[model samples]
Target: MSHIRLLVPLLITAGILIGGNGLQGTFISLRASQEGFSTSLIGLVGAGYNVGFAIGCIYVSRMLRAIGHIRTFSAMAAIAAASSLAMLLVIEPTFWFFMRLLAGLCFACLFATVESWLNASVTNANRARTLSLYRLVDLGSVTAAQYLIPGVGIGGFQLFAIISMALTLSLVPISLADRSSPAAPEAIRFNVRKLWNISPLATVGCIVVGLTNASFRSLGPIYGQEIGLSVTEIASFMSAGIIGGVVLQYPLGLYSDKLDRRVIILVATLGATLAALYLAIFAGGDEWRNLAGIFVFGAFAMPLYSLCSAHANDHAGDGEHALVSAGMLFFWSIGAIIGPLFASVMLDLFGPGALFTYTAVVMVAFMGYTGLRMSARPGVPTAARHGRFRSLLRTSAFFNKLAGDGKNGDQR
Candidate 1:
């Protein structure tokens, strides 16, 4: 009860923040397509956003170090709100690209601020609960926000105004709340060589999941529009993956906790490969099958990062989980930065269906890598496991930083 009272403002802040971000992501893809932006150009815009987001993840840590959380959050939130409205001011692809880049930078900072606040407040005992509640806010808001697309009307300025309003009003909670904020987090470190030594499989796995997930997120709506779905249905199409991530995260997490996570990773990659194949070739014209395929693909793909984190922690030296988590996100961001362009070119050459082809190919490569790694090294002993498999939001570096902070234990 005390915890709820203390964190309610921050939780509300996070929910509203993610809601606006969710709306903007789908809104841009839908609107860009409607404006006749080339599929490649739209993908570039999305890639530009990821580029800004990646920079923000590293930059926000330093910015917070210099300025503290409240000022950073307030300023970033304001910038994000203004950036949302800026999209409405100009309709060109280049302009939208710049707007999304700015939004990404702002969201990256907001997430870091919110997460650092949560981490500083929760004890090791309550870390899981705090993180779970945070995840609930994240998944719920992002999923529901997608439904705003049809009602707001993709062609009009209404959705942009609404997103900006949400961002602006969200600031009120933080400003009015009387609770104390968390201390600033120390600078997070990332050493690629050390990360690879800890768990090469995790390093490879993060990149693959990033590539597959980023491509779908940035370009999935255009795929839906190409296949003749209305804007509302496209919203559902995007939401289905989030639903899959929510429903499947824990059960698979429980299973992975008890087994060689490499085995679990292999199983997940194979599952994603099959699902992507189904999406690419067999799910034609049937919304149910396409949605089901995406849901299953998400179910399999979303948890691998968590699984990889758990796997890496099992092999990491004591007190290195934070460092490794930061490194893993860096690897993931690299994949994300490159993924949209790669997928967009595929879409350009092969059509909307090729999006799944991109995923399928990557999952196959991932499966091969995991298979080789499993053959080369024995599994981390379950008894010796040093970390739990917690479902992480892939949106920002904040969660990755949090994942490293608490005592490691089996989550399920």
Candidate 2:
């Protein structure tokens, strides 16, 4: 019961952070259109955020080590809050690109601080449950943010103000808390070859998930607009995917543990591919139908990351969990950096439907690759594996730290 008390502040902090984080992608994509930016150009603006986020992960470890958690969190929160408002001050895609980049940068550091604080706060006994609650808080807040968008009306400054407000509110909880400082976060080492050797499929899966997920989140609003959906409908469409993820992630994960993990990966990628194709071909003019299809997309697409991550960790030695998890994220960032730009180009050259078309193609390619890998190697006999599935949250740098001192395990 007392542990719950400790977590409440951090959970509230997480919710507020995710709320702002959720709204930023959709708000910026929608607003860019209002400012008359081209589809490809808007995509670049969105892509800039991922690039900045990667930089934050890559570079901010040293800064966090120097400055400490509370100060870093507060600093990033202020910068993020200011960045939200700064969007209201300008209309250029290039300016907005930098602003989104700034938001991403702040969030990366902010996520690192939140995650480190959470890891530090927990004793080994309650770490698993606490982390579980944190993941639920994350998904719920992000899902809520989608619905919250309609209330603010995306065409004007109101939405930006709301994003700024959420980020501001996030600052209060952590700043006022009486928690002790955590030890400095570990310096992450990114070795690409080591990751590929651990599990080629996992490394590749992270990158492809990055490509598909980021494109959908960053450019999804534009796709919604391109189709016949209203702002309210667009919110619903985005939320549907998140809802699907929350519902299906655990059930499917439990079932996956019973079989070769690659089998589950194959099935998930196939479902994702089909969902993307459905959205591309059949989802026009009908919001509910679109919602249903997107729900399936989320169910399959979102869990693929966790599945792949779990698969990789199953084969890794205990000490290497952190390195493997962090490296997987490193690849994910590479894919995310490139995903929006690529998806956006498809939108420009083909149509808005090209958004999903691109995702579907990628899924198909991944599916074939996974099939090849499965044939070549035997599944780790279920008894030999030590790690379990952990849902990966893009909100934090805690991927390596999530499982708690390497006892419970790491990310999705």
Candidate 3:
């Protein structure tokens, strides 16, 4: 097959995955609302997804090691499809929680498969560009999905079915394509205590990032409701935050790469704190103003995890990168699980605005801690480059070889 032909299937697969994932952000809360779920129940639904995602991350690599990428990817997609369709028949909060959990598990598998594929396929010269393209597809698809809510309506279970179909459809290209499987990491068990010992700042950064992100994802809709925004408006508002994250990541990442990563993290934490404070205190009842605050908040807050991931990788040895990534994932998941419950209680007690208030307080503490850490133990100078995107492109061959190796032998 021509290389150009190969690109078509890969890009299509990316589109399907991105679009399918994007739908949940806009639809999940609204769907729960239509079924008369309470705020706490809705929070549980969101938490279920993250908990499942964390579980998937822990085990899916082993599954891939056992079955290879294509089979595992296909099976996961099928499971996700079944789970999505099942939601139509089961409307209870408990049932929906299980469904969301299943969906999250499938999502983690699909994401792992696709990201590994992308990582393996690109040559060093285009690694960054390919990753950037993948991210762009994700952001664009998510933005488009936000606009899809009004047409589908909150009552339509068919939307979930449609998302399931998209996930299922994602397997077709990979199943038939000529690309090799990507190399999965060896089963290096991640220990949170060990990770903290390696880079305490990075460890803390992941936890904070996870807490902020999960809270925002799960409760943003409820907050929107309390503030009296319409469903469509809420979709737009959430989309704005996502868009902010997508648009700002490159520049911010580049800027961070130029100096001490801890310094960059500290600045981002402080900036996010200010943004959250602005939203919590001055947002008032103006919908547009509130949306703007969300955008700013996302611009600073959402990228923290990625920055932390990169920083952790920076301090880790080559063999430890995957372990560090896994550790970060673990901490992030823990944060995700705890964030919604805490944020929800705060909202219930102090009002919806307390969500942002909680975020701001967390950010302030994170910033303060980062400053103290940096002052206490300044580490070796990081790569003085502008962005990882360029480096990624140059290493595409490494990824391609890694993918080819995974096809022929067990990564684990």
Candidate 4:
């Protein structure tokens, strides 16, 4: 009860920020297509955001250490809100690209601040429950915010204003709350080779997910728009995928804990590959068919990160989970930085269907890689597994700590 009360302000702040972000991401893609921006240009804008995000993850902890969490969050939130409105004022693709970069940096810092604070507040006993509540807020806010696109209509400046308003309002909760800020997190260090050696399958899994899932999130709305989906249906299309993501998280998570984690990873990649193939080859412009195919794709796709993270942790040494988690995210960001541009070019050269076709190809490659790794190495013994399965969001490194044993965090 005490924890819930203490967490209310942070949760409220997270919900507001996530809602605005979710709406902004989909809205930007749709708006860029509406403005007749080239598919390549739209993809470049998306890549710019991921690049900024990677940079933020590298430096934001230093800012948190120097200034403290409240000041850091407040500063980033203000900048993010301004950036949202900036895009409204300047509709040029070049301007949007830099603005999105700024927005991504701000959001990364904001989430890092909030998540570090949340980790500071919880004890080991209640950590899992606290994380579950946080995930619920994340899922609800992101899914509900998708509807704002159709509700507000996408062609004008109103949606941007609303996004700015939501971001600005996010500040109210953290600023007004009486809670003290947590201690600063360690600076992110990307020892990529070390991580790959620890768990090759997990490293590759994060990369594959970043390639496929990030591309879909950034460009799927463009796909719908090109195929003649109404604004409402586009919103539904995105929402169905997000909602379907929740359906399989726990189920697959439970199974992964018992079986060889690689087996589960292979199964998931196979499912996502087949679903993407269906969308690319069979779904066409039929609303229900596309919705169903995307739903299945999301179901198998979204949980890969958590699965990968768990697998990596299974192999991490003592006091190394936090480091491994941060490394995995860094790899994911690398793929995200490149995926949208590649997928967008495919869309331009081929058609709307090429978006999913691109994802199918990536997933198929990942599935084959998973099989090869399985043949080369053995799974972690069940008794030696470090932690139970916990669903994850690719928000910040601190997020993984909330589900960890708490020792690694203390060691840091």
Candidate number with greatest TM-score: 4
Give the C-alpha lDDT of model 4. Answer: 0.89
The digit string of per-residue lDDT tens for model 4 on 1-412 reads: 7878878899999999888889999999989888889999999999888888888888888899999998998899999999989988888999999999999899889989989999898887777678888989998999899999988898889998999999989989888998777888777667878898999989988988889899998999999988889999999999989988889999999999899988888898899989999999999999999999999999999999989988998888886777787888878888899999999999999999999999988988998888898889988998988877778889998988886658765222
* lDDT tens digits by residue: candidate 2, 267-369: 8899999999999999876898899999999999998888888898887875677777667777787899899999999998998899999999999999999
Q: Is candidate 1 or candidate 3 better by TM-score?
A: 1
lDDT tens per residue, model 3, 1-412: 2433556677678778777776875588777866788777787888888788888878877887898878888898899889888888878989988998888888877777776666556554554455556656667877887777766777766688788778878888877877677776456476767788768888888888778878897888778878888878888888988877755677777877676877778877887888888888998657999889989888888778877766765665535555766677777877887787788778878888898999998888888888898888865464532124211110112222222223321111
Clash statistics: count for each candidate: 0, 1, 16, 0
Q: What's model 3's overall lDDT? A: 0.73
lDDT for 248 (candidate 2)? 72
lDDT of each: 0.83, 0.83, 0.73, 0.89
Worst 10 residues of 4 by lDDT: 403-412
Which numbered prediction scores highest in lDDT against the true structure?
Answer: 4
How far in Å is the alpha carbon of 282 misplaced in model 2? 1.4
> Per-prediction TM-score, please?
0.95, 0.95, 0.89, 0.97
Of the two candidates 1 and 4, the one with more favorable lDDT, higher being better, is: 4
Q: Point out the higher-scoring one by lDDT: 1 or 2.
A: 2
Local lDDT at 270 for model 4:
91
